[model samples]
Target: MSLRTQLTEILPPLLPSNPSEAIKGTELIRLARLQLNGAYSDASLRYHFSIMSCDPASPIAKVEKGQGYYRRSAPVPALTGAQELLSLSQGRLDDLSSDHEAVDSALERLRKFRAVVTRYYEVNGRFPYVFRQAFAQGASLGNLWKFPEVVLVDWETGDAPDEVFALDPTMLSLKQRLGLPPFRLHAARLRIHPSLASFREDFFQALSASMWAQGGELIYAAPVEDEALADGLRRLNAIFGVGVISFGLTAQALDDLPRAANILNAHPRETEALMDRLQINRIAAPHTRQHIDWQSLDGLRRESEEVQHLIGWLNDCVGKGRAEAFRDEA
Candidate 1:
C-alpha cells in the first residue's frame, strides 16, 4: 500500500467538508511525508491537494512554517524535531519493508545527539534552553503520538541524575561514554587553593575511619603529597578497576593529580561554615574570604549550622555509598 493510504488507515477520520478538520488531517499527512522522504521539498499527494483547494491563510500554512522552523533548528545534521517525530513512528511503521533498519538508524542518530547533550550538561551543569525545550516538546509528542517505547528509552538514557560517583568499572565506562569528567579532572576544575591540603588529609582520615567502622575495607591509607596521592588514585583506578577518591593540598597539586575522581577541600569547621554562608548568600567564591564577618556571633552560628548540615549530608552519602545524597533540594 502507498504510505499515505497506510497513514490514513490509522489516523482519525477528518471530514473533507470542514476546513479546520481538513487542515489537521493534512498536517498529519505532511508529517508522514516528511518522515518517509527525509525532507519536505518533494511534492506529495496531500501537498498537491492543499495547493489546489486549501485556503492560502489557513492554519495549515502556519503549521507548515512551524515545520520549516523545526527542521532548520536541528542541533546535528541528522537530527531535528521532524526527525525525532520520525523516530517515534518506529512501531507504527511495522508494515514498511525498511522499518527495522530505519528505526535502528534513527535510534543511533538520537544516541549521538544524546551524547552531545550530555557533554554540554557536564561542562555547563545545565542544558541549553533551546535544546532542553526541543527535547521536552519531543517527549510530549512521543507520548501524545502513542510512542511509549521512544519515551521510555530516551528517559532511561538522556536524563541526567544528580551526584553520580565512580566506584566500579561499569559506572566508569558509563560516565566516560556520557562525557562525564573523571573525579580528578572535576576537582581540578573547582580550582580550590593549596592551603587546604592538610585539612583534606585530615578529612580523608576521618572518612576512612568512619568507613572502616562500618566494615568497609581501606586498602591504602598513607599520607602522600598531592601529586603522589593523584598518582596512587590513577594506579588504583586502572589496576583495581575502581573509582579513586584522592585529595590535592595545593593549587599545583590539582594539576598533578589527573587521575583522582573526587577532590574535596579540607577546611576547618568554622571556615567551611563561612564558605557555606557566602555560597548561600550568592557571594562569589573569590570574594568570600574578604566578605565574611568573622566576629558576628549570629553569622558564626548560622555558618556553623550550615557546616554541620553539610557534614551530616556527606555522612549520609558515605553511608548510602551513593553521591546522590549531595544533590541540592529542588
Candidate 2:
C-alpha cells in the first residue's frame, strides 16, 4: 500500500479536518521522505509545511505554538492551545482511551489544585508551605536571624488559622495530644525584614512580575476590613498598576483564633479578666476543653492525600501510555 493511503486511513480519526494544513502537509513530507529513501532535506520539509505556521486550526500547530507559550511561562495561552489540540483529537493524542475515567478525574483534580493554589496565593500572598519550603531556606540569609515563619494550611484542608503560635519544632510529636492536625503544623519561613518597611514593596513587585509573565494577579490578604485600609490598598493598586484583592479571615480562622490565643496566653488571670471585660466566654481547662470538630480537619487531610495519589497516578499513566503508544506506532 502507498504511504499516503496508509496515512489516510490512520490520520482521519486523529486529524479529521486539518484546517491549519498541519496533518496534510506533514503527511506530504512523510511521503516525500519515504520516496527519497528517508533522506528528505530540512529545507524541503520546511517549504512543504511552512503554511501550517500561519494556520492555528491544526492540532500540530497548536501543540508547537503551545510549547513556545509554555517556555515563555505564558500558561493562559499555552493551556488554551493545548486544550484545543486535546479536544480536536478527543484526547487520543495523549494515548488516553475513550473510557479513561481516571484521566478525567485526574484532570479535574488538577483543576481543583490550581484553584486552591490561586485562592491560597490571593489570601496569603504566597504559595503553600509545600511549594515554598524547599526554597525558603535557600532564598534568605540564615546568618541574619531566623526568618518570620508563616503557617500555610492547604486550602482544601479547611480554613487557615487566624493566628500562628510559636512552637518548638522538636515538640511536633505532641500534635495529637494538642488536638492539632498534622498538616497544620507545617510552616514556611518568609523572607521579609522584621522592620516591615520594604517588605510590601518588594513582595508586590515580585508578585506583579510573576503574574504578568505567567497570567495571574497578585492578591493581598487583609487581616481585617476597614474603610481606611481599603482606601490605602486602592491607592497602592493605582500606583502599582496591579489589582490587590483583599480577603478576610475565614470562619474557621475566627473560631480558631480565640482558642489559639487562649492556649498561648501564659497569664491565665489576665486572660480571664480580659474575657470578662469583653463579655467573651472563657475556655475551660485543657482537659475539659470543648469538643472540637476533628472530622473537618481529617477530611482536609484525606483530600491532600488523595490529590497526591491522583497526581502520581496521572503522571505514571501519561508516561507509560505515551511510551507504549510510540513504540506500537514505530
lDDT of 1 by residue, 240-293 (tens): 222222121222322332122111222345334322322111101110011212
- Residue 273 accuracy (lDDT) in model 2: 38
lDDT of 2 by residue, 174-249 (tens): 5447854322212222221111122244234433322211111233221212222234434554554333332333
TM-score of 2: 0.22
- Residue 10 Cα positional deviation in candidate 2, in Å, after optimal superposition: 84
Best by lDDT: 2
Compared with the true structure, all predictions reach lDDT values of 0.28, 0.30
Note each model's CA RMSD in angstroms.
25.8, 25.9
How well does candidate 1 match the true structure in TM-score terms?
Answer: 0.19
